[model samples]
Target: MSSVKYSTRVNSFALGKGKKLPTGNEPILELIALAGTVPGLTSLELNYPEHFKHDSLEDIKEAIEKAGLDVPALQLRWPSPRFSNGAFTNADAEIRAEAVQMVTEAIDLCASFGADHVLLWPAHDGYEYPLQMDYTKSWVWMVQGLQAVADHNPAIRVSIEYKPADPRGRTILNTTGAVMNLISDTNRANVGVTLDFGHLLMARENPAQSAAMCLQAGKLFGLQLNDSHGVADDGLMVGSIHLAETIELAYYLIREGYAGTYYFDTDPVRENPVEECGMNIVRMGAIIEMARLLVRNHPNLPTGRALDSAPILWETVMGGKWNTTVSV
Candidate 1:
């Protein structure tokens, strides 16, 4: 069987929605330990700045090692109230400088892993209302800031994730096209786009198509998996909704030689986050395994013959080709 390297966001474990923000070493340490226990979960996509600042890099590394897992990516969540107005794209020069410096520091932290990537979610770097901001200036600052961050250490990967409006009425990197444009403007090899399946669905873009675009552009740095109703980034279990899209995306990744870790960016508010996360791993694995089988037997994948053989693929995935694919 082809290899599938699985990883998940540690913050999902500490989602604790109704409770106080889960902070500091203990919670994260617990998350690391929990991640290590999930079957097929080999690594973790960690929260940057927050995790790095809470514990010394040395200590954090030790914690991960102790948990028997590795860090594959660092998600730069740039939407704190401090960055509510903006972070890298902020009008304030000082804040923009601070954001750049933060990326530099985050890159430094990733250096210890030799070549790990960082996930950049510019969640708040957009406007909520019309005519309340200067688009041209903010766009320039955002791109230039990104280029600076990418140049900090060309070897370290910067995977910029795009999402439709949420905390902010409209996010700058809200679509695959916009993200591709940003990648073009940055003109840096190390900078790439991270297409989150749920987010893509939220944006009404075909996840499979976006994945292909990123692959063709040589900027598909990584990916995040989770399912939603396509209205919000609910971070539900992968394939829970949009089953065909999820299956197609899995097929595309495997068929196109994507070797990066399949990261799960989920939110488990009141549910048992640990169990919920583990379920995501199993569900995503099933989809990917189905894709592998489809490829082994029919390789064109999501196009041409594969498109014509959709019914068979669905049958195999939903019914009997493998025990993992139980008819539901």
Candidate 2:
């Protein structure tokens, strides 16, 4: 099997551009230019806040062209009133409508930039107290809001990212199961799931298992590549933890014929952005290399049933020493 290509979220490199830079220079373009220089990078992911301020879609498109990179995906993380602070699942109908409008605008922007997908992480749209909110009402609100966005732009794909509570409390769609349920309820062809490996680790879901489940459900629209300490969403370099599991997950993707972009969704808040991103790229390349070796070494590896029972197969291949030591 050939190596899986990788992409980087521009937010991961914004801090490295220097703190004194003006906002108008467009950091997303700068990050794309950087990633374009990376040998195996096939695309780039741009978050909303970095490029949403551009006056027109043509400007954003021009920046991407100038950077020599394509925007494979776009994320809506800002315009705080619409996304953050529980606007999508707010109790008020007007608030929900506004949130839908914000996302619709984002979808339009995605179309303009030729982005393949739009990512929505409903992190803040959840309850902080048990009895303070109504579960049924919140689900209804979220579905309605998301439907509005989907209906507005059927051409662009929208992916809901699942993240368990951490810097916050009880996100609505905190698990892969919950996200799957949302996709079933919404029943939109253009709406799917964004599997973030770190978030799955934080949720205590086996990353390989989660990937298999999403693949089975036909909801795996995109992937966020990052490593975690199995506790918090560390966003460290790939293969930092769960080394064998990461390799197995890559094998699964290869078996399932997943052709979507693999995005590195780490944070640059606490570390040197460029250095960390470069390390992440190198680690990911190594992981892909290992996956290729696994496939080559096990020429007759299972398909269907054998692939479904991959945990046992993987354990047998590793001689039950998959977790014996940490790599990083």
Candidate 3:
């Protein structure tokens, strides 16, 4: 609506949850092909290992090209069967080294694909109960492991994706602030974050405010757009549940200089993945339209040297809803 185009990316596996409903098991090439059919999808965030059918990068690259998409980033899911316990901050030194090696290898793979970023989600890197592990040692090992990965190559951006808790009760690097701390400890400019909206909702952080804060800290490197009930990660379509929050998030993102794509992480379990993803793009566009309308009607909402109050923002957003007599 503002004449500003917002590009979109979909995680390769996200396109066909029905193929393995509630979870995804679609083949890499098929997923790529299906996602490409989605009108607005510009790129993909691939999960390493799973998404790689064979060692032949050419095979995958050719398939992706044939599908009409680009590989912008790769997600390094640390809780795979190979990394059952954890990756970055695993207690065992040997396992930790393997984890670091995996990340470095993924970075090289990303380079091969001409992708600029790698998403590191440490899904199982924390303990479920108290006294089950030594917090100090784990945190130290985690920091060192991350540093090792960051030090591998300064050219490739390593974006850490944080979750409050899911695969682990007390997931390491679980919050935005905690992730920011880890980025600080990593001491690499290329090390930033992939802020997932569903994870933010589960963490009880205002997605809009979190985007603003993370952008301010210069740590918001990537974004995953999805929705949840705030109770669990439903992976519902983006605008299905949290309309206001999603719109506000778009407002902040558009207000800031978010030039990256909104990577779709939705679970289209009973729906057509291609149709659902296209719908997600359209939904995000509607939200962006709301943001555009709010700013258009109340021009002062975003024109300031400092952040506006929450009430001011909510009021402006609420004001966008109107019933005209002509409509009746």
Using lDDT, give the best candidate's number.
1
Once superposed on the true structure, which residue ranges of model 3 sit more than 4 Å away at CA?
1-25, 293-299, 302-328
Put down candidate 3 lDDT per residue, 211-306, tens digits, no spaces: 898898878888988888997777888878888788778877777767776777777766777787889888887778777666566566655543
Q: What is the lDDT of residue 278 in candidate 3?
A: 81
CA lDDT of 160 in candidate 1?
85
- How are the candidates ranked when ordered by lDDT, highest leading? 1, 3, 2
When 1 and 2 are scored with lDDT, the better candidate is 1
Models, CA RMSD each: 3.9, 5.1, 4.2
lDDT winner between candidates 1 and 3: 1
lDDT of each: 0.80, 0.74, 0.76
| Candidate with better lDDT, 2 vs 3 | 3
Q: What ranking emerges by TM-score with the best candidate at the front?
A: 1, 3, 2
lDDT of 1: 0.80
Model 1 regions more than 4 Å off: 16-26, 300-307, 320-328
